[model samples]
Target: MSAQIKNGTILLAEPFMLDPNFKRSTVLVVEHNPEGSLGFIMNRRVNMRVDALAKEFPEFDAPVYFGGPVGTDTVHYLHRKGDLLEGSDEVMEGIFWGGNYEKLRFLIDQKLITPYDIRFFVGYSGWSDSQLQEELEGGSWVTARMDPNYLFKSDPEKLWSQVMENKGDTFSVIASMREEPSYN
Candidate 1:
């Protein structure tokens, strides 16, 4: 765990992580440092439509997601065109986070970007840096390098299972296991 977890890394929750919000979840770590860590849950989707959000915040149009149970009022976005905007930081090679709001608005208005091109999250999942490292060591999370393709997945509901399956046969076995095992 000597290496620091940074943006774009995928965090897979361990089988025993009982927190209902995070169990069997895959998260994209968007920020990390000594101060704390921040990320969004990749598998949770809110029923809200992009057009609905666009109507509410006519200045911006994007897809919405359940980031986590934390700060539900704050908005965060993950994007592939992140480099084009100031303050955007590359989470992985083709993915980034935190960019200019005006630029986002322009992209949305021009139809240059679609809801599938970026994900909007309300609030975010956070962990103190030490806490995250501890969780990693405890086998509460499996860290993997991220690919931008995973972030813009068309079917987020299947993203978690797909990621776990990609990890290999061992993880595949885990993915197939029932949440609550039955005794015959």
Candidate 2:
């Protein structure tokens, strides 16, 4: 791949993408290798909270996000807890994803990890070998350096446009386009 697509790369969906699953989605790539790639949609928060989906989870007001279309029945998480959560893989300088689940609960119960330290998701995006490369070549996604603030702080509804505008130039122009412009 000509582009340095790697862990922590943020894949911004092209403005007029038609795929309902990822239209205007901002995906944070957590794993990318020869076999395939895995990531979570960072901006597509579902209308449900995490505790509503799991009684075992510690009491927290955080919402559960729609990570992607695949593995909708499963759960995943991204965090800034680092080694504090055993087995958590560092996706970049500061972000981590997944780890020993039971240990995570233990840390949460101990008041070591707060809602701001982690974000949960119901599923994740996946790409087969060469699939993502093909999509990148086709312009379905605009790759950007993953920014933690975009994932942790930006308003979910404004994330796609915010990231696009931050790109500053062609991307900003694209960000300003109407979601559905009539040509007739």
Candidate 3:
């Protein structure tokens, strides 16, 4: 509760969290305000792709991320193609979420935006006003500074622990723990 949460902060799930949707999840907070907060789970890559779901979309091959349990019917995206994608809102330094959809297709078709420059999500994680604050108070998450490069550059399977490891010291120790500790 005392931590200063803001857009671009990485929300790391606490070790051994029980929520199946969020255990070992790493989320990028895209919006924060009195109304609520919204973000996409950065580490969960679903077994699907953009063009697979929408044949109309150009033949773009890339991993489709599972943003969260909310709004599975819709698609959302995060990217670093600020001006190239146009009308994008900066979630933080170097990271931008959303823009003109038509322009996105055009950029994808023209090869102006590469897979390295963006990530698509099936849905997003949302928190309502006091809900996030309550979660923070309840020890469900740990906040860390974001290095936007980590989004596209880091291995998704290791993201949660990798990010936690980057925080150093005790966090590194925690990161070394197996996800299913009982097996050990």
Q: TM-score winner among the candidates? A: 3
**Deviation from native of the Cα of residue 177 in model 3, angstroms:** 0.3
Q: Candidate 1: deviation at residue 10, Å?
A: 0.7
Question: What is the total number of backbone clashes in candidate 3?
Answer: 0
Per-residue accuracy of model 1 over 1-184 as CA lDDT, tens digit each: 5445876788988766799999878899888878989899987888775556543354444558888888987778888787566778887787878798777777777877777678888779999749988888878898766777777854687777778878887888776666675621
Tens digit per residue, CA lDDT, model 2, 1-184: 4567899999999888999999999999999999999999988888887777876977777888899999999999999988798888999988999898888888888989888888899988999999999999988999988788887888888998898899898988888887886731
TM-score of each: 0.87, 0.95, 0.96
Query: Residue 94 in model 3: shift from native, Å?
Result: 0.7
TM-score of 2: 0.95
Ranking by lDDT: 3, 2, 1
Q: What is the C-alpha lDDT of each candidate?
A: 0.77, 0.89, 0.90
Candidate 3: lDDT of 77? Answer: 87
- By lDDT, the better pick of 1 and 3 is 3
Give the clash count for each candidate. 0, 0, 0
Off by over 4 Å in 3: none
Between prediction 1 and prediction 3, the one with superior TM-score is 3
Ranking by TM-score: 3, 2, 1
Error of model 1, residue 31, in angstroms: 1.1
